[model samples]
Target: MSALFPALVAGSDRPALRLGADTLTYEELAEAAGALAVRIGGAGRVAVWATPTARTAVAVVAALLADVPAIPLNPRTGERELAHILGDSAPSVVLAGAEDVLPAGLAELPRIDVETTVTSFGPVPAAFAFAGGSDASESPALIVYTSGTTGPPKGVVLSSRAIAASLDALEEAWAWTADDVLVHALPLFHVHGLVLGVLGPLRRGGSVRHLGAFSTAGVARELGAGGGTMLFGVPTMYHRIADALADDPALVRALAEARLLVSGSAALPVHDHERITAATGRTVIERYGMTETLMNTSVPLGSHPRPGSVGLPLRGVELRLVEEDGTEMRAYDGESVGEIQVRGPNLFSAYLNRPDATAAAFDGDWFRTGDVAVREPDGYVRIVGRKATDLIKSGGYKIGAGEIENALLDHPAVREAAVTGAPDPDLGERIVAWVVPADAEKPPTAEELADHVAGLLAPHKRPRTVHFLRALPRNDMGKLLKKALPEALHG
Candidate 1:
């Protein structure tokens, strides 16, 4: 059995994690995780009250050290989703920080309060725990919950082998090393914020400084003041940074001096990309992945990343676009869009307690990503949108909502935009555009916007209906709440 955190377990005394004012060295983290691991040993599965705190990281590490699967419960999860997850995973114990006040649904679960301080060091005794119970590589490590359009959230069962493989591939892609200091204000729940933001640093023997809550000032202070090297953020955060860059010299300098800036979860508008690079002279690279698959492709470090593309597949990942009838599309043309299918070791094992759902998720060894994209002749993948939500079936033609959204965002009067297909009597579905106006006094007219789209894309891709909103509803990750928009329109 080998250790996942080889540096921490081997008693390297360098700084490992810093959340707000609290910092833990590798030895201190090892002691804290090792101590908690012994207490939580033998629990089949555990739940963590995932907050942006040092205790949250410790709890997750401790669970890994004990070879127990952990479910990260977002602290702000609503009662219905929370209850559904608790009933689904049936965790043997729920671990939270001393100050965490869980919701009513978590009251019935067995509780364990995690302490953030530890002094004992000098090598972890739990190194053997990394590969135990005879399952070693395939043993379940994390059960991350993901939402669907129809039902409650499903648990994505990520094994130790998958997580390790993903991180290792990213390590090579990003040129990540122990000398790098990662900084972010990402939550401890999702894969980008937690697995990549937190655990990725730990695995490479690097340091991660969590801001607890995101603020442009805090980011500038940390990054500009020589406190960090690499930075990870979503499009929302980067948008704010791009907005503030003209006036905030600290943030501008921070971007200019940073080793790398990565964006994920949702697509960053090409307009914002131009704004950031214009101000800081550094392009923010993007990557593509999902809860079911940890990471598939990334704009590798030291490369001139494309503004709108998600770049080539990482090492050991095989990606291909397939037609509607499951026929493989081999042409390297940049126009023909198809559903993306992937085969890699970085994929999650199964959905917890749902064999039928798990069976439907795969086509033999290839997991259908459900995301539609066009591949360039150079093999770079540029995602158009999701097949379920973003693919618009118009009159005799197929369109991608992401392209229209990007076009709408390009308009000077439009501040934000989302595109969806609504039911149409004449056509199978009509293109509907939801936009937030940059100037409410003189918002762009539907005809003007339709012409604008027609000028950019084909005439058929123009929106039939345009709805102006005060603001677009978005998740924490900056993903548009597409399903809720229609229900919200009628309300």
Candidate 2:
């Protein structure tokens, strides 16, 4: 019922957003987005060519202000996937930068050049105000498509309430305030980058610095002596930071001085966690969430660092671990694994047009996340793996591929590891390890690596087969594409 960004209406001259050398104060951003919002006010929905630029951010903010749902199209998306998303969302117009060369699929739609619209519209009239518009909280704000790993990417419909709830909860959890300046170099399509990275700052009346493209040097420069106070990144970006910390004292200093560093999208390996902590004395915090749910859990500030845990359920979020039969698991012994189900205001309303899929994703009020995790007695959640791909039923035991992968990564000879279950004649399924060795010339023997996992975990957890690979298949977010690995190995 209130403006999502209070600062926009309150009006301030302080810096609000920065992308490279381009900086926009709150007054400038509000006027620009407000003017653009007036032109597209009555549209059914608008598609944003989500690029790592200030213009993309302005367009999304404008759409939100207009109470029109915004669909962020990934620039790097394949033609087929992009077509599928466009057809599913059926946006009234596509908003892009002035110089962007849109794909053929988006050519059919009416286009609004964001930069030109802002400049042409000039200052908004005095009557034009951002009084939360006329939309209800339940009205859709964004329709973000998933990775479509199972099938065609389904558009997950998120509401203004959900966005506001997620950001407010995160603010309380991370101690985020107006004084905090967030810095990141993540793609602007996904929830992690767009919702949390951009909108979070706007809601907090804080500032955000987009790096344009991720680079270790950029991180150091932004977070150096008197720069941004926080850094947000995925595991891949954090891994690069961990790797560079050894030779870059400036990077180490930058990270050390940061108030908060967060990693999400996929689990950050414990090895990289330790390396970064050892180098900078700052422990990186990890949070867990999915497209359906903006944010479910995060390691609260002031809590002791739990290296492998995704911390506790966020405020106003109710989380439960359920057994295979759909009954809730009551124990929190840090061993019994179960699927995570959450009920919260920070949840997507539905999948764009798939009623059957939307109905199947929820168990009454709780949305089944399909992610399996174990809980500590103190209520910390440590994600083991995904229920479908990461859960390996081997020799009558439910083994989590993530734990085994982490164990393999602990070995000095192993550089990257991914574990999966393959059909076996003797056992129902056998544990299989796909690894990229630290040194290709002198790779660790299969027997040696198998024994290494066995020594670290248990005999049953050890991989029955080890396949050395040049690299594991990864998505843009650095999450392992387990389904693509078999094809990659064969190719």
lDDT of each: 0.87, 0.89
For model 1, where is the 10-residue window of minimal lDDT?
127-136
Enumerate residue pairs that collide in model 1: none
Q: Native-vs-model 1 lDDT?
A: 0.87
Alpha-carbon deviation at 239 in model 2, angstroms: 0.9
**Model 1 — TM-score against the truth?**
0.97
Candidate 1: tens digits of C-alpha lDDT, residues 208-292: 9999999899889878885688999999999899889989998999889888899998889999999999998888999999999
How well does each candidate superpose onto the true structure, as a TM-score? 0.97, 0.97
Query: In model 2, which range of ten residues has the least summed lDDT?
Result: 126-135
Residue 448 lDDT in candidate 2: 95
Please give, for residues 400-430, the per-residue lDDT of candidate 2 as tens digits. Answer: 8989999999999999999999999889999
Residue 481, model 2: lDDT of: 95
Q: Which candidate is the best by lDDT?
A: 2
